[model samples]
Target chain A: MTRLITILIATTLLAACSTQPTEPDTTLYNRLGGQAGITTIVDNLLFEIGGNETLIGFFADTDIDRFREKLIEQLCEVSDGPCEYTGDSMAQVHADMDIDNRHFDALVTDLITAMTEAGVPTGAQNDLLARLVPMHDEVIHAEEHLNGDER
Target chain B: MPDRKTRLVTLMLTGLLAGPAFGASKILATSGAGSIEGAAGGGLVPWAVIGGYGSDGEWGAAASLGRVDVDDFRLGTASVLAGVHDRLEVSFAQQTLQVEPLDAVIEQHVYGVKTRVAGHLIYGRLPQLSFGLQHKVNQNPAIATDVLGANSASGTDTYIAASKLYLHALFERDLLLNGTLRYTDANQTGLLGFGNSGGEDPQLVGEASVGLFLNPNWAIGAEYRQKPDRLDAVDEDAWRDVFVAWFPNKRVSVVGAYADLGSIALWDDQQGWYLSVQITN
Candidate 1:
């Protein structure tokens, strides 16, 4: 029993030490190829969305250039880059968009396709998606307040 | 001869394959394949993630059939599982174990339920955590009592599991890690039945899995599951497996593994191949 405890402790310590990255290369922004790469990804994503029939309707009334700028800034900031996002909050921007799960999923799929086309590595794509996932709640139900519905 | 159990499994598979898709969708390969015990995981060990593609406020169901061929034994399993809002899961499985030379067949039924308590696998810092309970009953009690000297023909196992997916974990690949602690008195996962005649207590064991996602749809991993040593008649050892899982689409998945199930029913060094197929909606 004592031997088992000792082994468990040793294993835990080893796992902890192995996963922690040093200060030199811990930020996800650097791994994503910094601001230039992010701009390319965002540009490709907007272009793909613009061509997608199902998603194009959502952006018809919006300013494509301004939206692109805001998205780039948001991605850069969220990935721990030096840029700061000065756009409206996610809830505020999407509050009246009435985006459902299907629309949200379509946009994400387009984004992933764009990233792939931009030569973004799979790991970096997943990391960026992970950071964006937490904003799902704020983005998906922006119209629920007017409908007084709870999901 | 086709039995009632076989017919039920067939019907369940048909239903699962024919069911309409509904609910919020999770990313492909995020919901792992069903374990032999009817929980969502690898071929052998269950992970903390719920089964199927259902996100919050959605419903999903999955069914799988598996076969494991060992040196001296052959095991077949069929299971069906349902997930509610990606928070609670209920599952049922039937296992048939055939012993070589003796040509004896032992059958068991397992019913399981799991609930997600907290956390998310990818979105947050906290690892996904869940609690599960499984009740198992042997169809042939005589074999368990007379041949194996087991105390009971049925038992319950409870477990807590934590799972996490780390993007860019090493060399720019996604890594998935899981840890499980189980409290069980079952002998050979209840194939030999539950408890022991030696008046020993239930054991607490650990299980773990580590996987590398080569892509969004493919994962390669290894799992280790610790078992209890309750029955005095035969020595039981831990189980380990190396597996590859592929998700061609949201509705179909296949997992293949090489398993080392050391010592079962006096048959030592039971190594073999495992295969499973699943359909989900």
Candidate 2:
């Protein structure tokens, strides 16, 4: 029994060890091709979103050029790139959009399609998606959270 | 390690996966495989994920056929599942079990309802949690009640399942962990009927599964199910399976596994292959 327990512990430690990043040269931003690559990805995302009727409505009143710039900055900041996001907070920007999980799913689908079209590898795509997943709560329940803050 | 026969099977599976399109918004394989009991989960254990591709405010359904063949037994099942608003799931399955020695066939029907009570499969602080109940009835109960001295021909099993996904956790691949706590006394999952002949109480058991995503389209996993030891006439061992699943599109998924049922009734070393295909919309 003791030996079994020891083997189990060793396997767990090995699993934990593999999660650590081993590559010093390749940051997530570098894998996405840095500035030029990021621009292409964002552009591809905007094009796909434009064609998606369900998600396109959310951007109806927004200024396209500024939205593009802010999104690029946001992606860069999230990927640990060399840019700082100067736009409004995620919750604040999406506060009145009335977005729900369905819309969120559609948007995520479009983003993945865009990244795939931009030639991002599967590993890099997964890494970026994982980092952005935390913002889901902010995107969907922005009004409720903002109301809570006000209260 | 791609052999010619395996490559042929893979190509055939790829061909079978191409069908008409139906849309569901969730990411690929976020909804787990169709369990034997008709719930969304691994091949043997139920998971917290709701079946189908629907997100909030959306509804979807799935239909599946599964078969398992061991040295001495054969089991076949057909199941259908419905998911409402990404929160509630209702399912039904009919299973047939064939025992080689006795040349006896037992048919059973299962009805299940599962609801996700908290958290999300992805993007949440808490692991995805769900509560579910499965009611089973044996169509051919004469052998169990008359021969095995079982408590009843019908029984209900309740469970709480939790699941979580860790991104880039193992070898730069995503890892999924799930645990299910179940309450039941059904012997051989109700194939031999419910409870022991001497009226032993239902026991709490554990079921768990782990999966590593090789890519967005493919995953490899293993599952273990702990069983009750109530039947004095027969010894029932635990169940285990290692599986590979392919999601060619939102419409279809295929799962193949090597299952070890341990021992069933009088037969020992009950190991076999299991395969299932599901279509969703």
Candidate 3:
């Protein structure tokens, strides 16, 4: 009876663990189609955002080529690729930009559109978006001015 | 002539149409259509996602109508939900179950509240987690007690759900996964009533959904919901469904599914179609 109970408990524990979703062994960078794919996606995303009137104002004074390179590097580093991002920290880059949730969401939309057009798998696109989502706190600074006097 | 329910639904539809179109802030398809219980989720399972496009300090509301027709039974539900600050959601739902041949009608009033406890579905390493409670009351206690052998006319279900959107899981598609643990004594989702004459305890059950986004607006998924077997009169089996959902725009969504409800009220193999339409602001 004791031996039978031990087997039953082991089987139940294994079944429970098997029900949970497991992460894949492959890194996100490789899943995102590597360097060339990332470049194409970033280019397409920037192009789409550049054409949008609502977003073009944010990039008007920025250097297109340098910005593109920095974005590619940032994405590569974030995805665990063989590249280093030399760009400024997210907080430092957007400190005084007055970026809000609206602009951040718009950029994310453009990025998703670009990834979709470039045939980046939906899973990879979402994975990348998940990593970038936490940056919203560092990037959005509209409330700072609203409570300026209090601080 | 349209009945009072029809007129009320029409008025709500008109209001939804006239509501201002807010800019879509949340990711498309992130705020899923209202579930049968009036919470933001899939057809039957309530996901951890908060409803609407509302984020912090914002408010949003949604209305939905759903119909599930099986071999022996038919269920119709209408619900409205409001979300505050993307953290708390409160909702109301009315369900009507129609039994064929016997032509018995069971009605239920459900009031639900869910709060996002932690994490972000798309942005964080931790999966989105939420706590939800649904208080359900059967309109006719005599019918419930006599036909279903229920001990009470009302019950409350409490659930904890965790949801995660896995970017690029299969063939480059985004996958949305959710798991829920619920404690309840409700029979037939509370349409029949709570507990039974068997002196059964409130059972803990599991529900899960796995969805693959074909695009930003479309998703295909499957769900499994475990149920309790309390009444000795008839056996209740688990419920499962394969579904497709379409988001035509930010304000409107439609879902169609094939569901297997198993034995319901002595009828077996209760499998058929499920359809729902939702409008949000």
Candidate 4:
């Protein structure tokens, strides 16, 4: 029993270490065609998302203008630019909203649309989304918590 | 390093794959208009194929089995559904409500028709709205006092009007919201006693659900389902649930959910877990 437990603990630690997140790449900035490209993608994405009646319910009380500006600033910062994002953490902002997977997926759809509209090309869109994919782990936690505790 | 270029190539390939994932497809919740994947008890949700034909000419089908246990009574539902011509769907179900010594079973068969109303730019940029209607022909009334040594109960006839609004790019992935209004005037649906007949008004139930695909075959959804209590005696609480489904391929999908079953017999407003699996070809 002791040997089995030790092996299990060691395996768990190895798995966790193997999946460690790497630092955001600086090359993404150049690949995204700098600030202008990020701005265009955000603009197109917001249009598609805001126009959706079901999805718009999530941002019903949000200030679209302010939200749009924040997105641009945040995207610019993440792409290795000089800007700093002062917005709330993704988890904290969406925590109390009962934002389920549907909402999250909808936002993802909007993001993809924005990329398409901006002519970022499929290759670049996929690259950007790969970086954003990890955020889904933090942003989508309600169901995880609910199911995690279920006996 | 070579590793860096390889990573970049991998990222580009993933991005290319994501576009096809967002193609034209409506995201219907696990329980929007069909079975709650795998939950016990039975109401309106159909259990069968995904209700639409895919890009291929062949149709698909799905099945779900679920059970609800409260006090000494248990209610279970097993259903199968199939799609044809990318528009029509037909399903059949057998539901059993067991009360220890006595058992009551209701059988339901459904036929549905749907067609895209328009795909033009409606008031700017709405991709398209599909209109559909479904009729449920039910049978096997096991509640007749003369036959089962129990009180008489009436049967029901129901019709569902459904609409699917397909929008690409409201979210990072394309999204679809499906809304349905159900009207049922069956004599036995509410379990009213003998000679009661149809004294109550028709049930006006409304359902709204949103579905988004993380990928073509994987979707996450949430739905709000509300059905008023037409009968004065029974207090039928409005029901709601959240579900996630995995459609591994075109013909098969599985669903699991946290469901609120309202009230039945003397169950404490049944709230618990549900699971359903469907197969289509």
Candidate 5:
């Protein structure tokens, strides 16, 4: 009886260590207060960054309104909110333009400004930046490839 | 003598070879701080301004070593800086500008100081405004002693500067704008100018640059600078530059720039290639 008890205890301990993480609820719509809330922030960001003269040239041939909607949709989808992401990989899309460090910095500043305008708290901004941090490697490497430059 | 010259050249070459590639990841002005360029003593166009992301802290610092072939001189400096809770920054820098004219290995030394005040314009929805003041101790006993002019320390020469930085995004694009204005005190040193009655005047120097973000970590940009002749008799020309900067992450970056430094004594126009490496924590 004692041996059996010991065996059960061991199994319990093993299970505790190996337990899988609960999957995040993919329906982020409710958590984010639905699409309306997300849309407001996205719209604000687009408007501010779009009117920036230094950054405006990058979108000379692009559509600001459509891009804003897409960004909102993707952000909403990624945060376990109820949504879908249909955009291209971050690298593939930015491969053609010769994006560099300065450009990246400006984008971060714009995003921060947009978030502030949309009332996203600092903690939330940090969380969002953490999630998107991985994309930096891809985007930069893609541009370097275009120029045949390597480090 | 030939061997010594060769060794010096080799040392300089090695320095260039090992220097950072993305410029300094720090600011160059005395008020902004955190740049290797400060060690060189004074700001040099294209060199000082062509930097990666530096506006992070309430303040940053930098140092550099500089040389002017025409004057046959070299200078070194150390600087300090602080940012105002990330909304604004105020900086102060002191430097030792030394010259090594042809025959003299250590010709003369001059002391310099610079101050910068920058703030993010939150009042009425305007962008951030960057301002600066740079001064030098003009009582150059070396220059004065050389010309038998005076025997005491001199007054504080000044330079006033301003700039506006903005970030933008449109559709799949990202952009940045940087505008600058500078007014120098004819008596003070502008960048590397060390002597009295010499160097560029206290006129307005302006800069405008635009960068397009290809992605979150990459970008391309173009820039231009306007210079005024400090001397009443000489005509000084302005310059322009273009560059490509690569950022692998926020912590590291490399930049390659083409610069035109107008004309120097024998070099006609001082145009060359520059590579900068920037590192951040």
Candidate 6:
């Protein structure tokens, strides 16, 4: 058992060393197929979201065109593409949605589906997801912060 | 007396009836495979996550069947588990060990309960932690008590397990790490009954597993389980396995592995194949 643990530890350390961040400009955006690729990914995401019952209601009142533009911009900005995000903050935009963990997970599933449909490689998909995962609290608890402001 | 099979079928029937009302909420593949002791985990160790797809407010249930074929013996376990509000889990497993030499079988029942104490698997820095207990009853302990001079036909194992998922940790695949510390006196996991020549006191043992999700539907991993040497009749050795698990959807999953059960009773180098399937609501 000790031997097994030692091997696991060694493997983890090796993986950590190998994962030292790659040069930004070359990997993520290129893996995501740059802006054209990002657009395709966003279109596929929209299509996927269109078919999801749990997430459709949230977008019912949204402006599809603007939402598309902002989402593409956000993805591009996060991927460090030569684009600027002109959309509202994640918390500000999602403040009134009453979103929950289940909802967020559903969206994540749809996003994964969208990315998979867009033929994004697993590594790139994971890289992009890592960038976006930190926003979970802001997205789901946006309403709580809004209420806190009121109180 | 209602045999273990009858009890298992009854529980499965009840779960099937009640499952659809409030199940399948969590993301796919989060509810790891079921262990022989009926906890959600790798085949050999219980993980910290509760069984099934229930998230925070939902309920979920699952049933599993597992088998292991070794050089000298064959082992089978059938289990059912329920997850309540994604916090507490209660489970039952019926294990049978077929001793080819003795041309006999030893059957046992394990009732387990685990509660998530703190943290989350994928959310934040803290690994998911849980506390659990498995109360095991050796239905037929003639060989254990009369022949091997075991102390008891029943025992309880308590453990604290922690698990975490590192997203994109290696090769951009998700990696899962689980560790458990258990206090137990059972010999061969109670197939040979509890405590013997080694001592009456339970010993602390360590168990661990590491898995990498190849995708949302498939994962490959390994497990190591330390054992206590309490029986004078034979020396107990640790267990290990290399496994591949497939979670096709929320309803079903399959796990297959190559296992090395070091030694059991008088047998040596008891290496073989292991397979298990779990159906989750």
> DockQ scores for all the models shown?
0.21, 0.42, 0.21, 0.03, 0.02, 0.34
TM-score of chain A of each: 0.77, 0.82, 0.77, 0.70, 0.69, 0.81
Where is model 1 more than 4 Å wrong at Cα?
A: A1-65, A76-84, A94-110, A117-119, A130-151, B198-200
Q: How many Å off is the CA of B76 in candidate 4?
A: 3.4
The fraction of reference interface contacts (C-alpha pairs within 8 A across chains A and B) present in each candidate is: 0.26, 0.48, 0.37, 0.00, 0.00, 0.35
- In candidate 1, position A151 carries an lDDT of 38
Give lDDT tens digits, candidate 4, residues B1-281: 12333344334334433433221122223222335212111223422223522311334344544454444445555555444433344554444455554555544333444443433111113333444444434445444333422223433334333333333233334344555555654332333222223443456666665555444445555556666554334445655555556766433456665566566544455655556554433
Q: Candidate 2's residue-wise lDDT over B1-281, tens digit each? A: 33343354344334434533244777788878878888988888999999988888778677777889888998877787888888999998878888988998988889999999998888778999999999999999888888887889999999999999887677777889999999997998999899876774699999999987766778877788999977777789989877788988787888998888878888888888899888786
Q: For residues B153-265, what per-residue lDDT tens digits would candidate 5 score against the true structure?
A: 33233333333322223222344445556564332233323323542224555655544444444555555656655433233456554555565654444555555555422
CAPRI band of model 1?
incorrect
lDDT leaderboard ranking: 6, 2, 1, 3, 4, 5
lDDT of 4 by residue, A18-44 (tens): 332434574556556678888888888
Global local distance difference test of model 2: 0.83
Clash pairs detected, candidate 1: none
* lDDT tens per residue, model 2, A1-151: 2332354455445545645454777788988889888999999999988997668998889999999999999899889999999998878999988888778888878888888888987678888988888899988889877888788
lDDT of 3 by residue, A1-151 (tens): 2332353345434434433243677777887789988999899998889876546898879899999999999999999999999997776677677775557756887898899888876567767876877777767753553356347
- Give one digit per residue, the lDDT tens place, for model 6 in B31-67: 8897888899999999999998877767888888889
lDDT of every model, 2 decimals: 0.81, 0.83, 0.80, 0.48, 0.43, 0.85
TM-score of 5: 0.44
* Candidates ranked by TM-score: 2, 6, 1, 3, 4, 5
Q: Write the per-residue lDDT of candidate 1 for residues A1-151, one digit (tens) a residue.
A: 2333354445445444544343566677876678888888998998888787657887878988899999999999999999999998777788877765556655767787788888876767877876787776778765654245443
Q: Worst lDDT window (10 residues) for model 6 chain A?
A: A1-10
Q: How good is the docking of model 2, as DockQ?
A: 0.42
| Clashes found in each candidate (C-alpha, N, C closer than 3 A) | 0, 0, 9, 29, 48, 1
- On residues B1-281, what C-alpha lDDT tens digit does candidate 3 reach at each position? 23466467657867977987454566677778878888999999999988876665567778888999988888888888888767899988888888886788878888999999998776657989999999998887666688768888889999999999877565456789999999999887877678999754699999999887766788777788999988767778888887879997778899998888888877888888899998888
Extract clashing residue pairs from model 6: B198-B230
**Candidate 5 residues A1-151, lDDT tens each?**
2332353345434434433332366233443346776787677767776776445777888777677767887888766676788876666668877665445545656676676666654434444654554465567567654455434
